[model samples]
Target: MLFDSGVRSGSDVAKAIALGATAVGIGRPYAHALAVGGTDGLVHYLRSVLAELDLLMAINGYPTIADIRRT
Candidate 1:
């Protein structure tokens, strides 16, 4: 799945992963965060996205990202 969730939220990341995105490219959010809050913001954003993905996986009963499937 092709995903573009820069201005969006972590939930979108989870959705994309569940939809079969092997890789998600974070565009605008990352660049803007880096320009404003520096490296810390970028780190925070990544962490949040990862947590969202994990939470979604758990909610869907997927043991791993590889197990996430489109229903």
Candidate 2:
């Protein structure tokens, strides 16, 4: 399942995955990015989120998003 609402950082995505979420979502940050920075902000925010998620996965010992396990 995809998680949302409170999801803000890569760590949050990792947590959701660990709890059995197959996917995560972009909510306020996404909207805010677009509104505040236009296309550039949205693009930047998306990349940041992706990078954060990757970093979190590595820190949590998951080689990939598919490998994240339930805590």
* TM-score leader: 2
CA shift at 71, candidate 2, in angstroms?
5.3
lDDT of 2 by residue, 14-65 (tens): 7788898877887899999999999999999889988998887777687867
The digit string of per-residue lDDT tens for model 1 on 1-71 reads 57666525666766777777767788987887888888998888778877877787788788876666545
Stretches > 4 Å off in candidate 1: 5-7
Deviation of model 1 at 61, angstroms: 1.0
